[model samples]
Target: MGLEVERVNEIAARVAASSGLEVVEVDMRGSGNKRMLRIFIDKPGGVTHEDCANVSRELGTILDVEDVIPGGSYVLEVSSPGLDRKLSRPADFQRFVGSRVKLTTRNPVNGNRYFEGRLESFQDGRLTLELGAPKKKVKAGDSAPQKVEMDLSNVEKANLVPEI
Candidate 1:
């Protein structure tokens, strides 16, 4: 279950990169008898159904050639990340600037640890976010980034919150 998914993800990544797209995320699940592998991808132009189809065809051939999946019957699903992307990498934070994000910390901060706010910046292992409070502006290269200091280890989970 685990290694097969990783292998599929690796194949999806290679095929996407070769096709000028970015592999977003991959999910592998089972329905008691069948397995489903969902591969998400994105790019500067966003991703279309055609893109997913193309990746599915190509990566499918690659996976079959590699025999990553055994005799277990499975279905392959290729998709896009949509608006709510799981923030896993520092690069994910940078990609989501100017958007609302929900984050939980490893330990509490300011009586409550969970935060949902406007993502400001991510640079040099630092993430600065403006919580939904009184609008206090902070200039570039100032104390604002310091106040929002959160060690990467403190990030338990992060997701782009839908602004609606």
Candidate 2:
């Protein structure tokens, strides 16, 4: 099953690249005939409805030809990752430095699993975040905002917190 998902990711990446886009994520869910394959794509300026339509058509045909999933009908959907896009890769974090983000770690750090802060930097596979709200109150003139440093490997999920 994992291999099938990897194959789908590879196929989606290759197809998206040919179409001048990058595959942000490929998700395969459900089982049997109910399975659905969702592919998220993006580029410098962002993707259009046409981009989604083209990728969907091309990837669907390729998957069908490759016989990747065997005897099952799966719904194929391709689209832009959107404003609150997920940060799945280390480079994603690096690209969005200074943006607000909300992330969850696989294991609790400082007895907490969730964090929302401004991304400060990403270097050597580590991320530094300027925590937006301090866990404890400090006098106005006492201290600067707190910071948290975490390794990429510890991240279970992360998304850009769109600042409106």
Judging by TM-score against the true structure, name the best candidate.
Answer: 2
lDDT for each residue of candidate 1 in 2-46, tens digit (9 for 90 to 100): 887788878888999988998888898886448888898999768
Q: In model 2, which regions exceed 4 Å deviation? A: 135-145
Clash total of candidate 1? 0
**Model 2, position 112: C-alpha lDDT score:** 67
| Residues 95-132 of candidate 2: C-alpha lDDT, one tens digit per residue | 89999999999987766678899999999999999888
Candidate with the greatest lDDT versus the true structure: 2
Cα lDDT of model 1 overall? 0.80
lDDT of each: 0.80, 0.89
Instruction: Mark the regions of model 1 whose C-alpha exceeds 4 Å error after superposition.
Output: 133-147
| Residue 16 displacement in candidate 1 (angstroms) | 0.3
Colliding pairs, model 2: none
